[model samples]
Target chain A: MNTSKPAAGKAPAGGGRETARRARTRERLLDAAYRQFCEHGINGTSIEAITDDAGFTRGAFYSNFASKEELFLALTERENRARLETLRDRFDEVVAPLGRVAGKPDPELIEGAIADILAVQPDNRQWCLLNSEFKLLAMREPQVAPRFLESVRTFQQELAAMVDTALASVGLRFSVDSGHLTRLLLDHFESAMQEAILAGAEDAERAVRDNVMRTLPSLVHSLTEVRPPGS
Target chain B: MNTSKPAAGKAPAGGGRETARRARTRERLLDAAYRQFCEHGINGTSIEAITDDAGFTRGAFYSNFASKEELFLALTERENRARLETLRDRFDEVVAPLGRVAGKPDPELIEGAIADILAVQPDNRQWCLLNSEFKLLAMREPQVAPRFLESVRTFQQELAAMVDTALASVGLRFSVDSGHLTRLLLDHFESAMQEAILAGAEDAERAVRDNVMRTLPSLVHSLTEVRPPGS
Candidate 1:
C-alpha cells in the first residue's frame, strides 16, 4: 500500500522516437533486474540498485514500474512468456530431425530428440534459484498465493497443450492424461537438474542429460507402448 | 573473511550442571534460529534477531556460536540428523504390522507401507525452502561449495545405506545401484511434495500423499521385482 501508483504518462508513444527510447530503457531495466535478482535474490535487491545497475535513476525505474514488487511480478510474467515460447521453439528444433523419417518414428530417435528437448541451459541454476524463491514467497504470502497459483495453473495448462501438439506431430500420445504427465515430467526434469546443479560436478550438464535420458525413455516407451486396446 | 572465527572457550564443560545448562541454551538458540530461518530465510535473518528471539544477548550467542554462518551450518547438520532418525522410525513403524503377518506379504500392504514411509513431513515446505536456499548458495559461492557438497554426499550415502538395510529386512532390494535409485527417488518425492505444497490446496497433504502413492508403488515394485535372474 505504500508503493507508488502506475505512472499514467509512462505509456509508449505511438510510432515516435520517444517510444523507441522508452522501449530500450524498459528492456535494459528488466535485463538488469533479472541479473540482480538472480545474483542477490529478491529481498537482497532494491529499486535503487536495479536502476543503478541499468544506468538509470529512481525516476526512470518509477516511470517504468510502480514499485519493486510490481517490477518483480512483471519479470515473472516476462520469464513465463519467454519460457513458453522457448518450449515451442525447442520442441520444433528437437522434432525436426525426426521429420525425415516416415510413419511412426523410431524409439531411439524419439529418445534422443526428447533428450535434446530436455537438455539443461547453462544458466539454469540461476533461473531455478530465483524461481524457487519466488514460488516459496508466493505460496507463503496469502495476498499473492491465489493469483500466483492461478498463473501457475494457466502456465502448466499451456505447456501441456504444447506437449500434446508436439506429440501429435509425431503420431504419439501419452496413455496417461497428457497434462498430468507433462506436469510430472516438468517436475522430474527440474528436480534432476537442481540436484546436478547443486552437486556442481565438472559434467553437470551431462549429469542432468544422462539422468533425463535414462529415466524418460522408459517412461515414454511405457506410455506409448503399454496402452490397452480402445474401450 | 569478515565472518567471525570459530569461538574459543565455547566447548561444553565436562558433564556437570554447567554442561547441562550450556546444552539447554544451545538447543533453545537452534530452535529459535530454525523458526526464524524458516520464516525470514537465512540472509534475511541476523545474529541479533536470533539471540533476541531466544531470550539471549550477543554475549550468549557468541559464547555458543562463532558467527551466523556457523549457526546456520549447525542447523543444517541438526536437520539432516533429525531427518535420518525420522526415516528410521517411520520405516519401522510402517513395517511393524507386516512383521506380525506370516507368508508372502500382500503387494497392496507393501505399497501402503512404502507410501506411508514416503509421505511428506508436516513442516516440509519450510524445510524444502531453506534447503533449496542453502543449495543455491552452496552452488554459487565457491568458498562454501566444497564443504556443502561433501556434506550432501555424506547425507545421501547414509540415507542410501538406511534404505538398503530397510529393503533387506523384507528380502527386497533395488535392481539398480541402491544409491542411484535412492537419489532418484529422493528427487522424485521432493519434487512431488514441492508441487503439492506450492499448490496450497485445502488437502495439500492428501494431494501429495495420493501422488506419491500413485507413482511410487509401480516404481518400487518394478525396481524390486525386476531384478536379474541370479542376483
Candidate 2:
C-alpha cells in the first residue's frame, strides 16, 4: 500500500514517519522478492526465504504483505510502472527532436524510436525470466488470473498512449489498433530476448538488439502510415 | 532411448519384447508428466507424483529417465516432433490442391494455409503453459539450457522447412530468413494463446484464432514475395 515512493520525505495519513518507514520496508521486501523470484521462481520460493533475503522477520513480511502472491502482485505493479516510465521518457526523448514534423517520419527515425524504446529495459534476461514465471503462476491460479490481466492491460494502455503520442509527433500513426500494435511489438521483443537468453549466447543483448533492429523496422514501416490531415 | 514408436512391433538393438515394454512405460510416464507439469509446474511436480500419476513405481520412472530434467527434455522432444508432424500434414493438406501454382498464391490461399497451420495444435493452453514453464526452468538451470535450445532449434528448423516447402509449392518465398519468420509466427501464435488463457476469456480459443487471423496475414504478406522462377 503506497509503496511507490519509498524515499518520499512526506507521507499522508497513518502518521508520516510510520508510513514512510513502512513503505521503505515494503520496497526492500519487494526488491528481495524480485531477485528470489527470478532466481528460484515463485512457487519454488517461500515467504521465509524472501523475508530472510530481505533481512526481515516473518512477522515483518506478514505485516508488509499478507502472502507471497500479494507481494508478487505488488512487485508486478512496481516493475510495470517503472518500465512504463522508462518507455515514456524514451519516447519523449525520441520525439523531442521532431516537433510536429511534416508528412511521415523517415524509416530511420521510426527505427531509432523503436530501438530506443526496446533498449530502455536494462535487465532484459532477469525480467524475462520473472515475467514468464509470473505468467505461468497466474495461468494455474484462477484467482490471480483476472488481476494479472488487469495489470497487463493497464501497462499496455499506458505504453500504447506513449506510442500514439510519439508517432503523432512525427505525423505517423499505426494502420492497426495502437494497443494491438504495441502488444505485438512487446511480444516479439520479449520472445527474441527470451530466445537469446535460452541460447546462452555471449552477446545475447546485442543479438536481441540486432534481431529486433533487423525485423521490427520493416514491420513498423508496414504497419504504420502517414497521419491524414484534418481528423 | 527410442520412445518414438512405442507401438512398434519390431525394435532395433536390445530384446524386442523388453524394449517395447520399456518404451510403453516411458510413454505412459511422459503422458502423465505432461498432464502433471501443465497442471502444477516443472519444479512443483515431484518425480513420485509423475510416477504415481502414471500408475508406476518410482523405480520405473528412474529406469526410464535419469532425472525430471531429462524426462522434461525428452517430453519436449516428443511434443515438438508431434507438433511438427501435425504441421507437416496440415501443410500438405493446404498445398495438395494447388497442383503447382505458376505465380504467387492469392492472399486468401496464404491466409487459409496459415489458419490451418495455426489450428493444427489441439491443446494450445496446455502446451503454452508447459512450454513457458520449461523455458523458465531452462533459463535457471545452466545444464539444461543448451539442450533446450537444441530442441527449440530443431523444431524451428523443421517447421521452417515445412514453411519453405509450402511457400515454394505456391511459388512464394519469404523475403526474410525462413527460420526467423517461422520463429516469429510461432512466437506470436503462442503469445496470443497465452494472453487469451491468462485473461480467462470464455471464448479464449476463438479469440486467439481471430487475433492471429487478423494480424498474421498482413505480417506474412509483407514478409513474403513470389519465388524467383530460376532460383
Candidate 3:
C-alpha cells in the first residue's frame, strides 16, 4: 500500500527493500497497461492481458491494483504528472534564460517556451488515442464522469498556474485572464495533435512543431498587445 | 444502391414508389441511429436496439446498410453535407446582401457570416460525442482509417473552398493558406464545443457564441492583415 520512496538510502529494517520491490512491480504494470490500452481499447484490453503483458500473474495485478479501471486512473495521474513536470522544467529554463532582461518576455521567446512545453514525441500518438478512449468512456458512464472531470479540472488548474508563473517571471501576463488563455491554448493544442495523429501524417512531431511555431508567437503577440476592455 | 433524390414527377413507373419508400426508411433509421449512438456509444448499442428505436425490423437495417459501420459512414456523409449547405447559405447571405452599393464586404459583415455559420445547437453535443467515438475507432482500425481520413480531407477541402470564397467576396485572403486556416478554425471550434459539453456548462450554446465571437474575429483579423511573405 505504501508506494512512496524511502528517504535517500535511509533503509529502516527491511521495509525499504520491500517498498522498492513493490514500487517496481507497480511501475512495470502501469507501463505495460499503457501500451496494451493504446493498442487495444479499454474494453478490448483485459486484466489478464495486462498482467500477462507485464510478465506478472493476475494475483500480482490484484495485489497492486484493484481493477483495470484503477490501473488506468493511476496511469492517467502518472501521465499528467510527468507532462506537468516536463513543462515546468522547460518553462523555468526559458523564462529565466541567461542574459535575459527582467521585463516582458519577447513574444518569440514565449513562443519558444510554449513549443518546448508542447513538443510531441513518437509515444504521444498512442497516448492521444488512449486518452480519447478514456474520455469517450467517461462521457458515457455517469458514475465515473465526476471523478474524471475533477481530475481534468485539477490538471488544467495546475497548468494555468504554471503558465502564470512563467509569464510573471518575465514581468508579463496575458491581457486576457491567464486561466482562460491556458484553457484555450490547451484545447487548440490537443485538437491539433489529435488530428495530426489521426491522419497518420508523416513527421507528426514536426507538424506540431511547425504549427505552434507559426501560430503561438502571433497569438501571444496579440494577447500581449491588446489591453483588457476599459483598462 | 441509388440513394439520390428522384426528379420531381419524373418517376420510372412503379419503381419510383418503392424507391421513395425505401429512402424514407433509410433516412428514418439514420436519424434514429444518430440518437441511439449518442446515448449509447458505437459498441455499446446493438443493432436490435437501433432497429427497435427506429421502429424498423432488423431486415430494414440490413437491407439499407451492411452493418453499423456502414450506417455510421453514411451518417457522417449526411452530416457533412447538411453542415456545408448551411454554411453556404449563410455565407451567401453575408457575401452578397441586398444593397445599392457593391464593393468589398465589410470586416464586420464577414465576421457576422463566420459567426452565423458556426452557430451551435443542442444536438451538436451528441454529434460531437458520436463523431469522436467514430474517429477513435477509425484510428484503431486500419481498414477503416484510410477511408475516414480521406473523408476528413475532402470535407476540409470543401470548407477551405468556402472560406476562400467568403474572403474573396470581401477582397481579402488569409496570410496563411486558406486550407490551413480552415483546419485551425475547425480544430479550435470543435475543442471549445467539446469542452463546454464535457463540463456541463450552463448555456453551452451561449458559451460557444461568446468564445467564438471574441476569439475568431481577432484570429481572422491577424490572418488577413498581414501579407504572406513575398506576396
Candidate 4:
C-alpha cells in the first residue's frame, strides 16, 4: 500500500473534477454563510441567503451539504481548529524558565497567553464572531444542539488540562477544586471575546486587555497560592 | 393637569374602545416578540412568525413597536429591571454576619444573587435566554448596544457597592481594584449563566456553586491583607 499521500491539488478519489468543483462550492458556501451569519446571526440567516450570497442555485447547496445545520457544524470545526492553531502558535512563543518569577506563578505567562488571544487579527475575529453565533443558534435548536455541546465539552476539557499544567508548574495549586476554576477561566475569556466583538470599535481590544489583566491575577493567585490547604 | 394621565391599558386622549383594543394588541405583540426572540434568537425568527404567533396582523407589529430592534430594547430594559430587582431582594436577605463565612469573602451574597438568577423554572427560561441573546444583539448593532452596556455597567457598579458595604460592616478595612474586580465578577457570573443555559443536561448550577466558593477565600484574604503603597 502506498501510504504516502499525494500533494495538495492532486485528486485521490474517484471524482476528480467533481471533487475539485465540490471543494470550491463548499468554500463558497462557508464564505457566504459566514458573512450572512455575521450580519443577521446564524438562526436569522437562511439557506436562501447563503446560496444567494454564494451566487449558486439551491441544487449547488444541497449537492455540497445536506442542510444548513451541517454547514454550521463544518464551520464550527473549521473555526475551532483555526483558533486552536492560533493559540498553539502563541503558546509556543511564550516558553521560558518562568524566568525571574521562578518561585511564584508568572503573571507574565498567564497574561501573555490572554494578550496573545486578544491579539489575533481581524480575520480571526469574523470566524470567532460566527462561531459564537453558531453556538447560540445551536442552543435553541434541538437539531444542531448535540454536536455543538460535544465540541464545547471537548474544548473545555482541553482548557482544563492547560490550566492544570500551568498551576502545577507554578508550584501553587487550587486547594479545593481545580476543574471548576479552569471552567471559570474558559467562561471568562469567552465572555470577554464576545463583549469585544460586540463593542467592535478600536476600544474593543482595550476592553479585553484590561479584563484579562484584571481577572487573570486573581485566578493565578487562587490556583498557585501554595498556602496550606485548610488555611 | 391630569398628571395621572392614562393607564397603559386605558384609552388615550381621543379615548375610544379602539384605543383600548390597540393597547391589548400591542401588549400581545411585545410579549410575543420577547418570547420569540428568546426561543429563536433575535435574528432567527422573522416578523411574520412573530405576527402569526401573536395572532395579529403584520401591520399591528408597526402599531406597537417601531421595529424589531426597538422591541429588543424594551425586552432589554424589562429583563434588566427584573434582574436588578431579584439581586436587590437577594441582598436584602443576606443580612450582615450571615453574608460572610469566617475565612471567605461574602460570597453568600454573590452566590445568593446567582442562585436567584439561576433558579428559574422552565416557563421563565425565556427571559434568561432572551436576555443573553439580545445582550449580544445589543452589542452587534451600535444603536442598541448602549442599553446593554449600560445595564452591565450598572450591575457591575452595584456589585462594587455591595462589596464595599460588606467590607465596611466586617471591619476588614481593605480595598483592591474595585472597578476591575466588579467587572470580573459580573463577567464571571454572566458567562456562567450562558454556560448553564447551554449545558442543558449538566448541572451548571453545581459548578457555579463550586467556582464561587473557591474564589471567595482568596477575595477575603486580599481584602484583609493591607500593605504600604510603594513597599
Predicted complexes: DockQ each: 0.24, 0.50, 0.33, 0.30
Model 4, position A225: C-alpha lDDT score: 55
Q: Which residue segments of model 4 deviate by more than 4 Å?
A: A1-32, A43-64, A95-100, A105-113, A120-124, A166-178, A197-200, A218-222, A226-231, B1-66, B98-124, B172-178, B202-231
Highest lDDT model number: 2
Chain A TM value for model 2: 0.89
For model 2, residues A1-231, the per-residue Cα lDDT tens digits are 665654665655577778778999999999999988877778779998898999999999999887787888888899999988877767777765444556666678778766776676777777878888888888888888888878988998898998888777767788777887678777878888888888887777787998888877766766777888864
Error (Å) of candidate 2 at residue A20 is 3.5
Q: Which CAPRI level is candidate 4?
A: acceptable
Q: Backbone clash tally for model 1?
A: 0
Span of 10 residues, lowest total lDDT, candidate 1 chain A: A222-231
Which residues of candidate 2, in runs, are more than 4 Å off? Answer: A1-18, A52-60, A95-110, A202-204, B1-19, B55-59, B95-110, B228-231
Model 3 C-alpha lDDT per residue in residues A115-146, reported as the tens digit of each score:
66666334566778778888777766655556
| Tens-digit per-residue lDDT, B1-231, candidate 4 | 666755677665657667778878877877888767766767787988889989988788886778888877766666566666665565444435433555444545445544543453223345556766776666667787766667666766776777556445544433446665566666656555555556663655565455455654444344443223343
What is the DockQ ranking, best to worst? Answer: 2, 3, 4, 1
**Top model number, DockQ:** 2
- State the lDDT at B64 in candidate 2: 89
Q: What is the alpha-carbon RMSD of candidate 2 to the true structure?
A: 5.2
TM-score of chain B of each: 0.81, 0.89, 0.83, 0.65
lDDT of 2: 0.81
Q: Give per-residue CA lDDT, model 1, range B1-231, as digits (tens).
A: 677653666655564557878989999999999989888877789988898899998999999998776776777788888888888778756766554555445667778778777573556667777777777666666666666666677778998998777666655566556776676667666666666766775666677777777766655554553223355
- Give the whole-model CA lDDT for all candidates, comma-separated: 0.72, 0.81, 0.73, 0.64
All predictions: root-mean-square deviation over Cα? 8.6, 5.2, 6.1, 6.6
Candidate 4: tens digits of C-alpha lDDT, residues A159-231: 5666556445544456545665566666666667666666665665567667677767655544455534453
True contacts kept of each: 0.27, 0.60, 0.30, 0.28
Candidate 4: residue B29 Cα off by (Å)? 6.9
